[model samples]
Target: MQKIPYTTINGGSVPMMILSVFSMITFTSVYGFDSVWTEWWWTYDGFSGPAWWGTKWPICTMGRYQSPIDILPDKLLFDPNLTGVVFSSEKKINGNLTNTGNDITLFVDDVIVPLINATSGPLQYVYHLHHIKLHFGHDEASGSEHTVNGQAFPAEIQLYMFNADLYANYTQAMSSPNGLVAVSIFLEVGKIGNEAYTMISNALTHIPTKGQQHRVHGLPLSVLLPQTKEYITYEGSLTQPQCQETVTWVIFNKPIYITEQQLTQLRNVNKEGGSHLLIFGNIRPSQPMYNRLVRTNINFRPKTKVCSMVKEVFYEVNTVQTRSGR
Candidate 1:
């Protein structure tokens, strides 16, 4: 990590470590500017895998509020106060999609791009879209970071937004309280391909290796999201380094669709130094619940599948409402 030199009263230079609030890292798969073009510091396996994250960033092991939790339908509390998240998307947004070595990340040009933000439903302050990270596994059965009753999706799109009302920039917001809102949308393989995702897939050829970037222009941000806004909300930490517990996670209840061909393209993207080894399995394992509260607006009584595995979790659900309120 390169430290910028700070000039003191005596004109002497002092090394200062970059202290980004959220990991000072918006994410693993990320959200802030501090680590836009940094080299691969940590990994998904081997010596620097998730298991060893705490050795360098202690919060990964010590923190009570970790992320990527397996959401059991039976272990969810239905919050009447919870409505859909209020999203404001730019009609057309411009950004650069970069292969950040470990994950593919998209960062918007805040200057040229009109403000794309979201508020309400578990959010207290207005959050500005900072970055987007794509996480996947080597195969279909093990890609998504967050699982449902131990069932993982093909991929996960993590849209990291920082509180614009509370902080000046993504870097500053990442370190503050009520700092970030990570909107997670799962991707399922389907016959039809989402146009927004198609645009991304087409652009993948331009950035076939690490540290490469492709300019994406005139993209409809709303097209990237599913029609439904219903989601499960929780208070958790970033899935990356520093693992700050300042994030509010909004995981969409409904999944967006993508094509199998697109999935293959992502799996084909080469890792650092343009090695033949494709970039795959960049997801983090699910963390402990730690007695944290998980809230949702979706009523699942009629749709609930009996999962005896989740018998010990604590939650509140309206039996009468689900039975009568259709």
Candidate 2:
């Protein structure tokens, strides 16, 4: 097996390492810009595909555990034995934000880095937070990569982690079947903006053009995740070209809210090669689930409990009003 070379550096100084992990990487140039034209080549037109994958990128079309599947609620298996995720406590970590023309990525490095680790929850190994990537669409209506029971969201955020017990570096880990784990969070349009996303969003101004990057300080991983750990787990492949069937996916049940303006900013970011052309819909369409069983820890109780709670609240409020004689 060929080993991928990787290193850690502070202040956004490390050079981009090109590897066979993702085929679109071959399009990166010496100046750190990736061509928008090259990124568009691999994207599938819709939910199903014997994609542009077979002829050139065969693994994607042939891979059994392909990702971005439409998760059917009725099809999920309720697994009581699945352990809940225990993540490292929230803290600030130094990182860099960069635009690859297709998506925005943030890398967590070791400059005053806090120890970040997560265990259990369908994982056979402990994993550490490696980095983050954001996926969105050209329009507000349909940008998310993964859909819930055929419903698509405005965007999605993926937190990539490496099995610390197995491989020493993240890049080296992607080649193996159990090497990588990604926690996916869906993003919806709402009135309030998420403060956790501000660190990366603020940095976008400095790196508005493709291939350009800016170093970020004090990004807290704690703020980037959902308040609850309710998620659906399944085995799947990377959504990008040279799609490897190595990821253990954990898609959170609830979505974090962001404003419409913020969504627009993400859609309008420039592609690599420094063109004004905005890259829209940077997501792979849903693949076939085949026979994979998606397991979840959430046990949706019967409607009886919901009604009881509402009735109790109403009774308590009515009693208070009667006591006041109003």
Task: Return the TM-score for each candidate structure.
Answer: 0.81, 0.77
TM-score of 1: 0.81
Off-target runs (Cα >4 Å) in candidate 1 are 1-39, 112-114, 301-326
Which digits, one per residue and each the tens of the lDDT, describe model 2 over residues 53-154?
655566787777888898755566767777778888466767778887667888788543237877888998988888888988877657888876566788
Error of 1 at 32 (Å): 18
Q: Which candidate is the best by lDDT?
A: 1
lDDT of each: 0.79, 0.72
Clashing pairs in 1: 20-24, 21-175, 22-174, 26-31, 27-30
Q: Residue 62 in model 2: shift from native, Å?
A: 0.6
* Best by the TM-score measure: 1
